[model samples]
Target: MKRYESWGRYPTIRDQKVLTISSRKAPLPLPDDERSVLPYGLGRSYGDSCVNDNNAIIDTSALSNLIAFDPNTGILRAESGVSLATILKVFVPKGWFLPVTPGTKFVTLGGAVANDIHGKNHHRAGTFGRHVSQFGLIRSSGEHLTCSPTSNSDLFRATIGGLGLTGLVTWVEIKLVSIKSPYLDTRTIKFRNLDEFVEVSRENDPVYDYSVSWVDCTTEGDQLGRGLFMAGNFSERRKSRQPKSLSIPFPCQAPSWLLNSYFMRSFNTLYYNKQLSRTVDALTHYEPFFYPLDAILDWNRMYGKRGFFQYQFVVPFDEKGETIKEIFRRITRSKRASFLAVLKTFGDIESPGIMSFPRKGITLALDFPNDGAPTLALMKELDTIVLQAGGSIYPAKDARMSHEAFLASHPRLAEFEPHIDPRFSSSFWRRVRN
Candidate 1:
């Protein structure tokens, strides 16, 4: 038996049976009730959604392969196990880029589809699943399901953002976007409060191709919700530019004291002040802009051996003002440290994924070090605030959300239940399932 854990590095599972499938033709049979199965990608999920503690894990990392590509039309078909990093390496030089990408390039195609992952460009391009044209899935009933907008549509909806509960996705086809250059012309705008962020984001949304912000979650009083906003678009330069090759080499886990409240407050101040000019313009490589944390591998280790929790939630656009301030007020009052706090707006483009997280709203993601009960209590309080505000928490980044909160967040859970493959299950499913 092997061990397994999500990217958060918390709640590690020590007795996992891993099945590695290297090819699509590997006639792998589905698991039965004696042992439920879950398709495991790169295990980049921040929570337990990608893990199955009681059964087996079908490791798809070995199945990475590029099945087909049409450089002229920018449509590519590849195995579900293929990583975004691999795709960028091959296509970026050819002037193509993913229509939507999360904060990390190490995630698998299937995982991206499963979570319906969004990016800074979500306000324009929508989630990753929106660009996926089709895919092939194998279910517990020994049926091969070909899913797309036109074929097996129900299964496709269920599978996307379904958290790998529908079945095992073998391969997928995606529509790539054209890029003039691998660099972006970007601007940074600092905001002092939630109202300023909302106003600035609205003003920049129509003009910029991408937008996001870094909020100071620890700040309170007049400085509450203070942050640095960034907006960018692909540069007109047609020249191909490769991303710089830099990675953190086997860094040791940091001590808990390294990221205490005092340190984080000081860090946020420095980071926010770093952008001296109100709006500085620069040309930057897409790698750093899209995946800044990727430069430091194992950066999660900085949270210490106890690991951390990534709490991400979205409230309707109308609730952008007061609700956000209340959230910040509560966080500041609790004095919990959230080192990485990002805020962004989602466009009105609705995803086909039945359980997809993003919608037309404002999202805030925070990383909090696990301090046991106190942290759980804080999250519960946040959950209440979000639910009351007609918002939803992201399951992909949650490890301790209650069943009531899950049901509240996903009002269509009943409709999605019928599509789940009986033989597929996950720690997250069990925890939140009715």
Candidate 2:
């Protein structure tokens, strides 16, 4: 048996049987015993949504093969196992790019659909599912489905952001956006607090094609949400020589104590002031702007062998952001600093996936080292605030959200339950359902 873990590497499971799908037309594989099965992509999901504990995982990586591409319409059809990195490498040079992309390009096409992943430009492009024209789903009952807006529409919505429970995503056909060059005209602005961050976002989100912020979670009081706001649009300048992409491994697991609050405070301070100027503008490669963390391979090891947890929740825009401030205050008070904190505003555009995480709201994501009970307690407290504020947590990045929390966050759960395939289940599904 091979050990498989999510990106977070928490709640580890060591007894899963791996099954590989080598062809798009292959039959759905199952465990010899009673254990359930779930589709496994690149394992880019930060939590257990991609894991089926003590069961079987159908590895879809081998199904990677570009089936078709129409440069004239900016549509590309490929096997679900294809990574965003592969798509960019193949189509970017031809003046086409993913219609929507998350922070990392390491995710598989099927994973993107399953999570309904959103990008910095979500205010405009919406979630990745929005750009998916259609896909092929293989169910445990030996049913091959062609899902889209017009055909098998219920399954289409359910499969998108459905956490791979509906079935195996065999192929995906997504619409791409045209780009003049593989570079972005970017502007970086410094903000002193959450208020300034919101103001900057309001002013820039409509003007730019992409926007996101990096917050310093160690600060408190008046500096509680100090961070940098980054906005960009695909540059129109003639394409220049693409820089050589580089990947540096993290080398080894860092000691857990290395990411303590004291260290995080100092690191955050230095990172915040690195720009020096309040505002800076430049032309940057899409690789760094969209996926800076990808440059550091196996970077999750930085959180140490115990692993880490990513807490991401979104409060509705109707709340006027008071909820977000309160959550920030609670995090700061806990003195549990998160070195990797991101804040972004989702636009009013809704996704077709009934279970999609993003909505019109303010979403904040933070990474906390797994310090056992203390970290779990803090997350529970934060969950209380988010649930009270009528917010939902992103299942894609969750490891331990409660059943009540899941139900409260997703009112459409009752509607989605009927669509789940009987033979499809996951560690996350079992946890939240119980």
Candidate 3:
């Protein structure tokens, strides 16, 4: 079997046919002879779900365009290849925003559906799949189909987290939330240790619509897992100016070792304490609050020439989010510290996409600088802790999980496998098909 690589250090790609599609109305390419087709969005997925071995990969970024939007209901209909960045460019200033968004706005509508991404407000709204109304797709049989809750419900659910296995998502209609302003009223808080942060977070979450924390990965012992917490809601600006276009300003990369042992601690110290020294801030645009790290543009370059791995896994709420603490401590003790460790609460979401990865719990995501084999081994062990906690890793953020571990974590594997076209398969699809 040929191997498919990832954005980080994963290597090998031998059997992939890469095709780019444009924004104009064009018929999808497929022959009765082919087994299946996988739609590739912005190629932002960190790993191989969008990749396959010796098979067709239909790139859809060129086909992006806004189709329609219902101003009254805040519902948006757009082609599958259209990106979130394009939506915000036109809508934020117009008083509407995506209900749930990942860190980057570069993802396409079809990509969001395939990954079913969750945002900081996951505790209140769930994942991106929950906010979607319906999507247009081309199945493996060369037939076009539309899936949604009331229509092809199973196929719809299957496609949400289906990893592009059900078919190629061609377009989507989503419901956006209209806001009073394009600003955020943010509150930043700090915790002395991981234990305290988790405790305080649990207390604060019942009331806030959006909440997330950043941890100090370098500290140990009593201060192990210490971090900063930021919570916010839409700013109540009596009147809001139309939001500005996102400017890259200067395109640059994170300084090498920006998150290394020494540098990371100092950075965390300053950021966490900034909360106390600051006052009620004036109105800030939604761009900074909802996507602070994204401002850097291509910030992933910070990991250096070797690249990095973002390990994000959801640990289900067995007893009110306590397992999360154990996982955090394990990760820090292993010494695989990243720049930040994000922990947040998630609400009950109804996605039966056989591979859907969310539940009532807290998620912890950390990055690993690919120093070498040692780092990879450490992350593999960390995967075990997540599995034991009855959790599943986010495929969009994972590039190194083994198929055995994936199936063990998500027992609902069979539901998605049947839809695959046997003749057309991916390294990622083949790995877990057993």
Candidate 4:
């Protein structure tokens, strides 16, 4: 038995059987005996969704391999274990990039599809699953099913954002977007309040391919919601300035005192004011713009040994700007420090993922250091606010959401249960279901 923890490092798991796969021809059949299992990837999920405690997991990291690529059509097929970092190393030099990518590039292709990850460009390109053409799913029933929009359509939709419950994805084919350079024509816009954020998002969403904002949740009153909005697009140049990849090792977790509210408030002020220019335009490398935190290895250690909770939820785009403000107000009143609060808008493009988190709305993500019961209580309050506003919390980043909240957010949950593979399950599934 081996111990494993997801990216968040909360609710640490132990005594689980791990089956590491290194061969493409490895046979994976559903356990004939009465036991549960799930496919495990890069362990990028922030919560327990990827964890199956006391059960078993098939580690797919070593299955990384590029199966094929078509330069003319920009379609690439690779093993499910292939990381986005590997894809960038091999394809970015050839002027191709992923159609949609999350904040980090260390995630596996299978993980991306399972999470149906949305990015800064979600308003334009949709979730990562939208660009996936097909994949080979190995079921415990000894069936290797080819899933796509036109083939095994139900399974395709279910597997995308399905949380790896449908089956084990062995290989996948994705349609990559063509790029002239690995740089972005970036712009930063400063907004004083939540109202201005809505205005700027509305104005920029039509013109820019990407948009995201850093919100200061600590601020209250007139200065509330003050932050910087960043928008960018691929540069027209044929060559991008290659920046050397550097990593900073985090050998140990920081002390809890280091992540307190006072310190976080100061950091928020500095980050928001760091952008002196209300509007600044520059040709920036994609690395800094898309994956700034990736440069720091094991950055999660900064949260301390107790770990942290990443609360992400989306509210309707209608006249619910005040609802969003109320959420921030609640956070400020709680005096809970959330240093990493991000705000973005989701587009109308619906993903085929039955359990996909993104919808046409305004999404807010905040990271709060886990203070045990108090932290969980704060999340519960946030959940009430989201539910009242007719919104939903993201399951990929969730760990302690109530079963009632899950059903409230995902009305389609009843429909999804029928598609779940009986042989596969996870800690998250058990928590929400039981």
Candidate 5:
């Protein structure tokens, strides 16, 4: 068996067969005797979702190709392997942007569909799957089905947020939204405590297309949730600067203490105090707004040799104070100070996908470099708090979660299992299935 981890390399997976494809001239499929298959992207997922031990694997990065575009409506159709970064390079100049984008643009369209990702505009446009018109899927029966909201809706729904278990996604048809320009008019606000943060979010999160917070969790007393809140709208841009230093430098690593609590707190302070508060600022292109962290490529290396785990969960409006509070209390008490803590409000729930993660409530994401031993245990404890409150964790950001935990997090998982090929499951699916 071979082992596969993540871009972080924190976890190693064991498997039997692995396939890497780079060109359209080269096509590779599983042997008839193969037991299972799993498609991998940029290997960005922080867990075993792309790892299928003793089974078959397909790497899809090189399969990217733009098929067609409807200049009239801005609808785009392309191979599933196309990266959001690629789309940005093409459409941004044409005054188009993704209706829904996660934190990073390095993810594949197929990966976005599998996760049913959402972004700052989620409260307005829903999810990536919501904007996707249709996709081509290969089922266990070896039948390539053209699925959409109208036909094969079941598979369509399940495949969107089903964690890449439904089938092998071949291509996707997506609907793009028009933007004023490639710049962002953003406002940054400061808060003193958790209560203030919630109060401001209740007031502004809905009015803006993008709303997020960078909070400090290590502080105690009234400073518990002191942080920065940002709201953004589309604005005109002048031009963008291109620098080779901005590119991701692979094979580069950081020191082991990069994410230690002391360093994280310092970084948090720097970020929180950067802006004076409630000030209007115009940025150069969407790059700074939608992708501020993108400037420092390989920033993930800041997690050190152990890497980091992103604990992202959404709690319905009804459970924020009661349930979310409990989670925060645990993290603070354990001294696991995250370098980055983001909180955002979700909009409508009727997203275009079946297994989407959005609901009527608030979502929180915490990043922690794996420190070993009780750290994982503490995260599991936090997991129970999320599950018990009727909320679920995000699979895309997950690095470790058990079968029972997966079941608790995604009760809708089994609804689409019948359509999945037994030989096409990942360690993520295996956990939930077992």
Candidate 6:
């Protein structure tokens, strides 16, 4: 029996049947038992969205051929299994880059489209689905449809951010953004609280191509929401040699006590104070600027064998960001520290996908080591606050969210439900839909 797990390594599924689709022209494969199956890509999703439990999964990693590329127009067509890292390796030197990328480049093109992944530049470029020119989806009933904004438009919008419930995306055609070099001229500012952070973001977002912030989630009172704000734009100064890639391997699970609140508080203090000056500017390589966490291989293991959950939610902009501040207060009161707390604002630009998570608001993502019921309790508390604020959780990173919460957050679920392929299902879909 083969065991499979999502990137978070939680809720491991054992003895699931697997089918491989190696070619773009290959028809959808069915399990011998005739059970419903879901499309599985690189399995980078942090939760059960990519798993099917005792059922079957169609592996699409082998369908990774680049079909075509038009360097003149910055358009490229490739199989869905191609990783963003692969595209960067082959095209970054050629002066082309992904219009929008998540924190890591290890995810497959198909996964990115399915989740409608957003990045620091989301305020300007919108979600990844906005740049997708078209894609080919293979339904279980042998329907091969070409989807785009103006062609097979319904499926196109459904598949993007549909969580792979719609169908299997065989190939994706995307419009790439041109770049002069693989470097960013960055400005880093230290903010005292949420107000300072918002002010800095408002002043810089219009001018910067990319912007994100690292928030300290353990602080309270006068220092609540204090963190570093980073803004960047493509640099014209080109380097003759591409930066060398380096990764430090995490060989085994870390001790459960390793990442306790005490450790996090100490670490956060040092990290925030590392920059002595109020503001600093530098030209940095894209790798560190965008995917710093990728440098630590299998970093999820740091949460130990129990794994971790990333609670990410976006609340619409309020008069003074009071909802966000209250949520932060609850977290600090609980004394459950998050090592990687990211706070950013999404733009008004809407995504074509019916289920896309990003909206015009502030989003905060936190990594919490799973301490069983206590952790779940904290999440439930936070979910209530988000729900009241009309915010939604990112399904890609969700391991557990109530069916009611899912429906409340995604008001368009009715429209997207009819588009889901009848023969496809996933652990997450079943959990939330039920």
Q: Candidate 6: what lDDT?
A: 0.92
Q: Which segments of model 4 are wrong by more than 4 Å?
A: 1-3, 29-33
**lDDT (0 to 1) per candidate:** 0.88, 0.92, 0.73, 0.88, 0.76, 0.92
Tell me the tens digit of each residue's lDDT in model 5 across 21-102: 5643344467568577788876677766766766777778777999999989989998888999999999977878888888
lDDT, candidate 6, 1-434, per-residue tens: 22457887777787678888979898899886758888888788998898998888988889889999998999999999999999998999899999999999989999999999999999999999999999999998998899999999999999999999899999999999999989999999999999999899999999998999999999999899999999999999997676788999898899998888899999999999989998999999999999999999788889999999988999999989899999999998887867799999999999999999999999999888889899999999999999999999999999999999899889999899999998899999999989
Model 1 lDDT tens row, 40-91: 9888899889898868889997778899999888899999999999999999
Measured with C-alpha atoms, the lDDT of residue 17 in candidate 5 is 70
Residue 72 error, candidate 1, Å: 2.3
Which segments of model 2 are wrong by more than 4 Å? 1-3, 318-320
- Ten contiguous residues with the weakest lDDT in model 3: 1-10
TM-score of each: 0.97, 0.98, 0.89, 0.97, 0.92, 0.98
Worst 10 residues of 1 by lDDT: 25-34
* Candidate 5 ranges beyond 4 A from true positions: 1-4, 20-28, 236-245, 248-251, 278-280
Query: Compared to the true structure, candidate 5 yields what TM-score?
Result: 0.92
Q: How large an RMSD does model 3 have?
A: 3.5
**What digit string (tens of lDDT, one per residue) describes model 2 on residues 1-48?**
334689999889878888888899988998777888999988888889
Query: Candidate 1 — number of clashing residue pairs?
Result: 0
